[model samples]
Target: MVMVMVVMGETATPAHAEPAAAGSLEADGNDEVLTSKFTYYSGRTLADPSKTMIFSGNGNVPLAEDIAKYLGVSLGNMNVSSFADGECSIKVNENIRGKHVILVQSTCPPSVNDSLMELLLMISTMRRSSAKTITVVMPYCGYARSDMKRGRERSPIAARDIMTMIETMGADRLVCVDMHSGQMQGFLSPAVPSDNITAIKVGALYFAEKMVNVPDSASEDAPRRNVVVVAPDEKAVSRAKEFWNVLIEKGVPEARFAMVLRKPNLEEQERKEQPQSAAAVSATSVDTDPSTALEHEIVGDEEAIADCDAIIVQDIIDSGQSMSNAASALKAGGARNVYGFATHGLFSRDALERIDRAPLDHVVVSNTASHPIGYEDKPTDKITWISIAPLLAEVLRIISEKESLNPVFRLPKEQQ
Candidate 1:
């Protein structure tokens, strides 16, 4: 729990020993001159500039910039450009020889190909330039959904392909926020070390603060307290459980858990009888196929949803179709308020519009994916953007110090 602060040319210990307070100004400046200090913890006894050089790819400059500021190091000078016919040019402008090179990039939306290519070029260039270690800090791992073959489709596993490219290009380690599947780790082993940090812990803490209003009669044994955690799909059940555990640890009243079960052709049957936008048709197209259906049912005690607050937990909200359906279903079931916690806000296409029209109160998402999809300046009440920047900065510090990332990778025993 040793917290270090990165001020200009000096190391100061944070009074509160909190890593998130890095770069926060202390209240010591008098009226004569206002002075502020930036604090950063390197997880080290001695600070050395040559030890680490962080670089920001074009995909996520803002996040990379925040990480750099947190680490008290400037982003390594690198020039990335495109040719007339859409070719990529990369130049490592700074000498990064013998430094632990950390590159931050997220392959998400609009131009996944370009983003991936830029990251690959950066890794290749840095490796050839003799960097000691190359770590790819990808908060949102694109193409991760294709980790395994689905229904004998003769398609290259895109997740494996991306990992292979990185391994072939000489990456020492890969740090991603959340892979679509935890099993994707098997693909990176023995060649490149990979860490998939889940944002559930981050989301749980956030919701605990906003979702603290509980019924007075609520008890640990009862555990339903007018709030219900909804798992949008089977894949998200584990994440929902994790979120609930963290919420309870954060002192929110005990909550109930439920899930959305995929009921077969009910929607198809409805479509034939009376077609009406197929249930809850969303205009958003994060990963559009234009053919996916939205038909799900609540699988717990039906009475639990009535007059209760519902928080839908999901990993990634791609088209937002499932989310829209879940919100509509919960509201139709008489749920009072519907909130959402999605780890990756791939708020593609017109997701904002869909979310606005849906019966959801607010959807909290992590900045695992970069801009255009996250932290928009335009005012919106349905979405709340949370930053994993502190979490990323903390992980980078642990990596730089050659320490275990388990502390950040998992919730503490108490929280868990």
Candidate 2:
């Protein structure tokens, strides 16, 4: 049995004996007392603010700062530099002995490898320095897409390898946002608890606010502005359905669901099964551009999408080819205004320009990953960024309090 007392204000200390260490297990045959200045009654031992430290790597510093600010704490002092030969050098400038440490790092583009290495090194440093526990807050988990081997090729399961590395480096837990595949959690060892949270609710709330004031297109008794949530591919159908349900719950009266069916590229499929011979080499001569290789057609309740506003929901928007193609398909299927929403916006290699020229009216993505270079100079209103700091902070707080996280998976009461 355990008892946690939350004292308010600067009052006199209770008559109870000195509380045990933050993470120490006391077995004196009496109820354990876990009290602190910033403690609260959350049915578990909540993290004391003074003893909780937050650190960040080179990836997404702004996000880390926002999370710290939300939690009413300052970030820990940590210096990360590179050696003469490009080796990572990390130094934690604060004493984290027996303290709960949270490290914020996203393995994103422009420095994926470096960011990962820095995180691993930081975890090892904290473990060796006698930290009570280390929690890795990785908003964008790189290499998540390489989850499985393709066909019969002997390919490395990079996602599993990365998870193994993090766990081996002594991370107690991991928290990531919108992993490409939910199965990636299985890649981690059971010792390292992993949380794969979603930013779909955040995205849904943003769209709900934008569509709240939209007047009814028909009579007062008729449905409100016709809106359809679209899944760009078969894998995204579940996500799109979740987004659609949230929109309706948020008062989007006429929200509907649709999906873009992709035609299999027979030629490409045949080439993959062929051997690495001259014939296979010549077969690759065909245009392999994703945007033009395969065809897409919108399939769903036709009445729900005809002349209705379409919003494409996806996990990651890398290169913008699939998004552009999905938007074009929706427009061709009688969608008036096509929008795109994704959790991670990895706009690489002219993706922004391609989106600007595409049929999409607007695109919204969470700030899980930092924007690439030249993103600000791009002259287009098609891109919007929303922050996931509040959600992440809430999750961190729940974890610190050792409470059930089922609440975070649902839409907030206010939004509902």
> RMSD for each model, in Å, please?
8.6, 12.7
The deviation in Å at residue 146 for candidate 2 is: 1.0
lDDT: which candidate is best?
2
Off by over 4 Å in 1: 1-46, 213-225, 266-295, 373-379, 413-416
- For model 1, what is the C-alpha lDDT against the true structure? 0.71
User: lDDT (0-100) at residue 371 of candidate 2?
Assistant: 82
Q: Which stretches of candidate 2 lie over 4 Å from their true place?
A: 1-47, 216-223, 270-294
TM-score per candidate = 0.80, 0.82
Candidate 2's displacement at residue 409, Å, is 1.1
